[model samples]
Target chain A: MHAPADPAPLPGDRRHPGWIAWALLAPMVFWLAAFVVVPAAILLVYSFCERDEVGGVVFRFTLENYQRVFDPVYLRIFARSIGYAALTTAICVVVGYPVAYTIARASEVWRHRLLLLVMVPFWTSFLIRTYAWITILKQEGLLNGFLQAMHAGGGPFNLLYTPAAVVIGLVYAYLPFMILPIYGSAEKLDNSLIEAAYDLGAGPVRAFSAVIVPLTMPGIAAGTLLVFVPAIGMFAITDLMGGAKVPMIGNVIQNQFLQARNWPFGAALGVVFMLMFVVTYGLLQRRGARLAG
Target chain B: MIEIRGVTKRFGSFTAVDNLSLSVRAGEFLTLLGPSGCGKTTLLRLLAGFEMPDEGVILLDGQDVSHLPPYRRSVNQVFQSYALFPHLSVRDNVGFGLRMQNVPAPEAAARVAEALEMVSLREQADRLPHQLSGGQRQRVALARAIVCRPKVLLLDEPLSALDAKLRHNMQLELKHLQRRLGLTFVFVTHDQEEALTMSDRIAIIHRGRIEQLGAAGEIYHRPRTPFAADFIGQANLLQVAVVGRNGTTARVRVGGGLELTVASAELPAGARTALVSIRPEKICISKQRLDTENLFEATIEEEIFQGATDQLRLVTTQGTRLHALVANESAMQEAFHEGDRVYCGLHLDDLVIVQAE
Candidate 1:
């Protein structure tokens, strides 16, 4: 209603055609269409098709691939993946909230120092960090070595190639991602609002719950998305730390691509994974917008 | 009653508050008035237990509550920015303190309702703080503080953020609310007008020390220090000569060699320098000379129209400047233009001789 009155554009300025702008941006548009949109189309098409003995996708319509996704084995793996991601999101929240709050509330010199500490671990390659954990948790690795040096150690521990190690690696890798977002949220939080909470009779615990948590909810949502979504399709951490002993859906789909030579099933999994992301993210966004409102 | 004794706060080398001692009487509305960076807010924070005094003790009802946290202290502050909780509905914000003390749901709700009604914000209970107007939010903040019924209510310039019209209205509203509740209010502000209107007693702070503390009327009509006279109200601080001294009253000479009778217990004579405090409102403006004892001729140097009143800045023939306030719109309508000659006189009780030899 209060928009400043802008002058009319000159007739000469109309020479910049809309289609020329689109043509200038064609590369990025086509790249998304090919890499993201086209692959999604292929997955959508393949989800309804049958597969041949040689693993080529036969373009005959069928509901069998989606039905296979709901089978007991795949269903169990899907449930397990959700449970792991949910637990990872919850733990990241419980652990990261305080770290972010501390960093945000620290002195200016220490605030940057703490935020830098949270980010510095990312200087090395992410895969290398996960692999480094594999070396540490191996049968005769540093943990067992330290345990043995204490003199009352038992035989070599079978910690390697377990779900626990995968969970540990996932948490360690995603903790920084979680912290940065929560920290951004906490940093923007008004100090006066917190002081007001104290004046209102909120003891430390109630203040954090009713005021601090709700105020920083956007950061929690961002951190949850940053940690949970990546945790779903994680392969390297599970393959190295979980020792390929148990078949997670990530490894299952990886096997179809490399070992089993089944392009159709991999395409089917790709389509389902992308759909899960779309649905989960859509629900998350709507919920976030509602809370923000 | 609230007492602050020898309290000091320092952050590294910057001493925000120096050793300061003051007390607020029960059911009294006292303001800590000073300019910005004068430690009024710091003193308020020390009383609220937000910041601990590095040197001395704070007592509430003769009990040392210095080391206690803000939550443990029986005091509430209406923050300068009207720091209402953005996330909660107004009802929840007002009920926050009650909920913390484990007050039952029904009782806490009743108190919240009463407090909201006290601030005339009962209809805004469902709205969030951001949804309300600035004045409404300020009231919600006030309601939140008084809902707890703390022994002491500290207001840190709660109306400073408001627009001029709203601030003026809220001042009267807050004064009425404070008197009705009979709760001790420790108000802080840099605005002298706000201090004069709402305060039962005004403690004028300067450089972390109290320059003067007395009844509003006493502080305004008879300020003892030059700083207090200048800071608390726009006073004309001019040099005067001590012509002679009786038992209590001293005869002083202003520019143009005009003598004015000023109250002084006793003072030495043969002195050329003396401090005189005269409020702009007390000086009478005349187009012709009057039968007044202290009168001088001056030309208008500046004429400022402030709606109902006009402020006239005059310079005497002896080159001493004085400010005069004319209350009538007709006085302003027919007022002398800049450079017009006029006779001005000062009332005997209106002048306070701050320092005399």
Candidate 2:
């Protein structure tokens, strides 16, 4: 038998001379240094420093900011933020999978049209869309007005400025992120594999659970990360939809930076939040690779 | 036993299978042999219940299953691409059908092991489909389908994906396995040689219809239609003018006004235009004139050196071309070269009259 050949190198693998690669990557390197590396370095320095009485960061080295981030009040906010993000991710998956599968299995023309519908929301500004949701969900908004006009029992129930409204806003904003990746996986799934399952006497449910689910796990994983990571740090939606009534980790971090005027404490919270994302993403990536293998 | 009666399947404007009817005997290996788009694969899919026939009934052992879903059918298929579940181990794939049937764990394991052993793949039972070679994956697919032990097994050109030599080996292995299992097989293929070597009976399909169906020997030796004659094997289908009919034979005038007699039970009554099929190997080429009534002098146009035989392209004096194959057993006996003048002899029993259409 012939030995298995080595896998071909990925496109990102550097095959050119060192100088040429550095030249090609110069612009991206400069951008990352200016935007990402520089900001991260500044945040790291601020996290370990002291804040002056007037809210300007002092040069004296200190660890009190990191200690203050783990206090009960801030920890509770972090937990609530995770709870909301986790719930949003779960609902997105439950709602997005069937829509993605339907679009993937549609004929070529319809598939394009449905995908366009999914993406059309992204063309407008996100903040404008959130304001639009505010218009619809507020008391005496279109939905409550229509219900009252139809003589429904409940009149002007508190719909906006609630946790449910926050979730609705998050789901609306991140649904396409959940769908597009799953659509990609579902579209490439071989129809013959499903037929083979049926031929082997598997019922529709069993075939889907056993064969289809494992194959599309990569897409689900990617969608989960995309929906979960950004939703955790989203402060604008809670302020607009939840009316800033309840504080999430994002609101606390934002208040420290702007309202409370404590840049060091805010930088500490940001560093911890960034570390949590790295750990979660690393674990998810390992699990995804295992599923694919 | 499987019966497909007057089944018709249409895709939009194209009729994939048109009023086709066929019966497969129990425990026999029957092949649907045809070129691509001739509805052979579509017919196999109909039997497998992957496609429902638009117009007829498919009976499995006397029960009509025309509208039954594939999971409810008693037929299994080995797809051309193998279609093995990539996430499952070979053992799991082979046991999937049994698991669906709710077989006991111990029994399913034993049966899966036996099936893997039958395919000589027990050692690789733990490997995933991606880890296996192409031939091994094909064997896993075979084992997976057969482990279910359905009444009829449909193979849709399963060997077409392999290389030539591997396909040859798998053909013999599959034929042997079918005999040992004593299960009915409805195999579909476009390879004529594979059909001839592996099938107990061959059905030649053309344009969504069966032109001929018989044993391999009968199909090769006495093809009833010009399509079957030209498709199954290499044949020189000469257009002949019928001179007269005598009993079951007819005398026809062929190339360069050369008169020949052929079997004519298939010819239409009072037909003047006829076609006769003659295998190249049946024609004899000699330097000296043979003492036969069916002999004509021709000049060799080209000599093609096949591995086991020499093919000579001969043209009669009146410019009618004929091909003759001489076995290369002896150098002296097969010494015909290009441009050499020779006499070509034809036997009465070697010619078959076929329909032009």
Candidate 3:
């Protein structure tokens, strides 16, 4: 079928109306400047200034705050945060891929219903949901009691306030983020391609790896960015589930502002964290571009 | 070689393929020709093992593979959409089957190159499917399926996606490819001319049943059923009553007392009347009186100027309407105008009776 040609420009409209475009974009530009850009600019300035003893930002410039951010202890936390985020991302992919694929390929009525189920969790407050995890993972909580009742394990097992619990919380929170993007890609996949794969003598697994997975890589990459970037900087889950025993970069950054009363140091850590997200996003985008090319 | 016996496929309540039996001779290009939803595609899917027949067995080279999955069967399909892997390079897509079969890497590479060369797409080997044109992607799909060297290749309207000019070229190319490879081809299409051009045998399907199956010429000239007669080519169906029968030819009366001679072979024994098919091109319209057994005095009612031929709509003196396709020669084009009196002649050999419905 022939694509409709673009409509010809109206008479006397050879030049773009620059003022209308600017007027339409004004609100978004104002919002970004007021909230994101101005706050980021303030943080950048604060990162080079000192904090007074009275828990107020001092205008005196100093390199000490940024130097503290590079210390071995904070660096270790940064590495650990990356490790946790990577693990969370891997688990999200493994768990979310099949669910997303199933939902995507489901019959139309069921596909919408299943997607609604994935999003149903979002109607509740996120903090309330994180606390709900506490009720399930505590020593005498629903999980340990169920395990005990089933005779699958011997004791309450110190399940809460652990790294495993923290990971479980992180995965639960971000799994839908992984599922939605992957679903977007998988839903657009042509059924004939899968049939062609089978006709070409590739079994189900072979077809999945050779055709389906690569075709859906863009979604997986998008989901990874959605899950991984936020997971690395997430402080609440680690605090509520890890019981603040181990500090991720997010927890340290949070403690600097709230408990340590070190605004300059917190701003420095925030700057570094934002830079890492930029780098991670850039690498993922480049990988996606390479795959497309 | 392929043999299908009493296969039936149903999608819920809708029967896509009725109990159908067909056989393809070794290396023959057999086309399942039908309009959409006539079960031609379903039958092709049944052969490819994409859809299992609920009621029958399929034999591929004498082995029963009715319930086997597509990957287990030694068959490949060139999809109508040319379902080449968008993420894979042309070389990779072509080599995918070999890789799954666990052929040696070197042999797989060599075969992929050979298949690409067969389609004259060696230059596009490293490019993704999206990088190529529609025709190039179709070639890649062909290469991919052929590299496996399956006993049978199923093509689901592969050329339907191309423009008319390119489709004609690919029809010849596909015919040559099937010949060179010596593989049995089970093709499906709604296009009548495509089926006639490429198939060694054509199975005219209607509502999941084979109405008629024969070589292209036999199907065109002697369609057993009215559906087949009308589907393949333009045929003027005349309702006639048999008045008398000689040993070989029968005299049949058309509307308002026009008698025509038809071969007795077309009439069932003791049948009083029959529906007969006459190709439009078979009717001769001339200014001079014609010396034929079945001749009628007619008036040219309308003339349609087709590029190669001018179609003359004629009304006999007895008020029977018929269409005659005459060559578009300069003299003929000007000779047959609306309201001109002419003699319309039909040959006995051109009139064949076909089954109703």
- Best prediction by lDDT: 3
Query: For residues A75-115, what per-residue lDDT tens digits would candidate 3 score against the true structure?
Result: 99999999999999999999999999999999999999999
Predicted structure with the largest DockQ when compared to the true one? 2
Candidate 1 lDDT by residue in tens digits, B122-230: 8778877767777788888888899888899999999999889788888998898889889999999999999999999999998888989999999998887899998
lDDT per residue as tens, model 3, B1-357: 798999999999999899999999999999999999999999999989889999989999899999999999999999989988888898999998999899999999999999988888887788877777777888888889989998988899999888887788889989998898788999999999999999999999999999999999999988888899999989999898889999999898887888889889768778887898999999988888889988889998999999988898988898888888989887635467889998888888899899522
Q: Stretches of candidate 1 above 4 Å error?
A: A1-31, B241-243, B246-248, B251-261, B266-272, B331-334
Model 2, C-alpha of B202: deviation from truth (Å) = 1.0
Candidate 3 chain A, poorest ten consecutive residues by summed lDDT: A1-10
How does each model score on lDDT?
Answer: 0.84, 0.90, 0.91
**What ordering of candidates by lDDT runs from best to worst?**
3, 2, 1
Distance from true location, Cα of A43 in model 2, Å: 1.8
- Runs in model 2 lying further than 4 Å from the true structure: A1-22, B264-268, B291-293
Name the regions of candidate 3 deviating beyond 4 angstroms: A1-19, A151-153, B330-334
Better of 1 and 3 by TM-score: 3
